[model samples]
Every structure is written in C-alpha cells, then in structure tokens.
Target: MASYECNRDFPVEIIPSSCARHSIKCRKIIVEKIRRDRISNSIEELRTLLQTNQTNQCPEQPSARLEKADILEMAVQFLREQASSKSNESYQSGFSHCLQETLRHLSLHAPLQPAEREQIKRFYVHQRTSMHTRLSTEPRAQFCMPSKRHSTLRVRKSLWRPW
Candidate 1:
C-alpha cells in the first residue's frame, strides 16, 4: 500500500501541566455562573416535548439515568421531523443546536449502550438516502415536471455505489 511513505507521522511536543486544566476551568466557571442565572433549557423541557401523554405540570422527578434506548428513539423522531420539514431552515437549525448541546452534556456523564453505535449508523444511512432527493434538487426554480422514475434511478445508483 506504500503507507509508510505517506505523511502520517506527527511532531511531538511537551507542554507545562498548568496550560491545560486551569484555563479550561476558569472559562467554564465564568459560563457556569451565567447559566445559573438563566431560566431556560432544562432536561425537564425536553422530557415534556418528547412525552405525549404527560401533562405540563407533572410533579414527578425524572430518572437521571436516562436510557440510551429512549434517547435513540426520541432522536429518531426528532431527525425525522427535521428531515420532513425541509422548507423551514431556521426551525431545523434551532432544533439541531439544542439537540447537539443536550447530547454533549449527556455524553459527558452517561455511557452509551453497545447497540447505540448501530442505531446511529442506521440513522445516518436513513437520513442520507431520504434526504438525497430533497437536497440534491435545485432550489428556487420555476415549476418543473414531476418525473417519479428520474428520482428513483438516481436513488438506485447511489444505493449501489456511493463511492
């Protein structure tokens, strides 16, 4: 493969231990204080959004150990909603930002299940195939003919060899 000739090596460097933790801690504490003052963006809010049956004023504490299965299921619904509402860019962006932030916080404290990796892979594939039609077509164009077979042919080609 001639892999050894490729530029894969890295130049090593050393740094003082204080350079890493202290600055990060200082920045985090500053942001953390501001967050305490704000009253928006809570896990309870997400649980409320995801739950269909529950009323707004539930007097129960949620389990801190949220299951990966539940999270993945909710994520599937969220992504589907985003993928379907392709006309609205702002809504999708806002939802994506919120989702990423929530996931970042959760991932720091919780470990994902072994099955979650496969779940994520499946989601990626689904989104890619389904969104290909919407994203590949030109936007802001005049009315065009709706040829069903044209789209299907492209999809089949992608499915066979996406290389």
Candidate 2:
C-alpha cells in the first residue's frame, strides 16, 4: 500500500492514499455542515423578526406555523410597505413645506381681505387633508404636480400695491 508521511512531524504515521482521500471527504462534510448551520441560523433570526414586526396579523390563525417560504414572502411584503410609507412621509413633508411657504408669501405680499385670505387657507387645508387621506388609503398613490399655468403665482396687477 502506498503511504505518505509529513517530514515536519517528529512521530510521523504512514498515511495510506485511501485514508488521505477519506480525511479530505470528512473535511468537506464538516465545511458543508458549517455552511448549512449558518444558513439555518440566519433563517431563524429572520423568522423571529417577522413574528415581532407583524402589525396586521391574520385573523384566521395569528399563531399559525409559517413555512420558510411564507416567512420570506411576508418579510418582502413588510419591507415594501415600510419603503412606501417612508417615501409617502417624505413627500408629505415636502408638500407641507411648500404650502407653508406659499401661505407665508401670500400673507406678506398679496393684498387681500381677511375673508379672502381665510378662504385661500381653507382651500389649501382641504387639499392637504384630501392628499393625506388618499395616500393612506391607496397603496400606489401617484402625486401629479399642478400644470405650469395653474402652478405659477399670478398676482393680479390690482392686488399688487408698492407701498
């Protein structure tokens, strides 16, 4: 039987080629087991996350057993919902800032009666409320900017007075 021995070892045991091949196979199996363990641990962690972050649990079976595929699908859906909510919040914040600036400009520069100013304020408030409601109700709500003709600040010549 052909044997291999390490020169570095003080007490070298003759290792047959068959034994060497078997050792290599054992190492491969150990490595594969470690890889599988890591994957299993990761999936377990994901399962815990899905359980904790479940806001709208199913009414039928809230504590039902979830398959790996179900957990993954729910995680994807949760992440997408989170992303959409964040984007909508950002959009609403920007819209609010613009509305405030517009209102401030009108109050400072535009010559209008108290009733007219109140009317304009109410109109904008209504629009903002409607937008918020729509965004909350619709999963895929799209915001379209007003046309250029409608969006531009057109101060009537009569309303503008240089004091």
Among the numbered candidates, top TM-score falls to: 2
In candidate 1, where is summed lDDT lowest over 10 consecutive residues?
Answer: 138-147
Error of 1 at 36 (Å): 63
Q: Specify the poorest-scoring 10-residue window by lDDT in model 2.
A: 139-148
What is the per-residue lDDT of model 1 for residues 1-163, given as tens digits with 9 covering 90 to 100?
Answer: 1112212253333233343455566788889987965523444455556553222223253434344455445545455545644744564466457756766776778976768756755765675556555544522110121234654564455443345
Model 2: per-residue Cα lDDT at residue 101: 89
TM-score against native, each model: 0.26, 0.59
List model 2 lDDT by residue over 1-163, tens digit each: 3333434443444445556766777789899999999988887888887665542342233555678877766667566657867977897788788978887887789777889888988987886887677655443211111123422332132132337
lDDT, candidate 1, residue 56? 27
TM-score of 1: 0.26
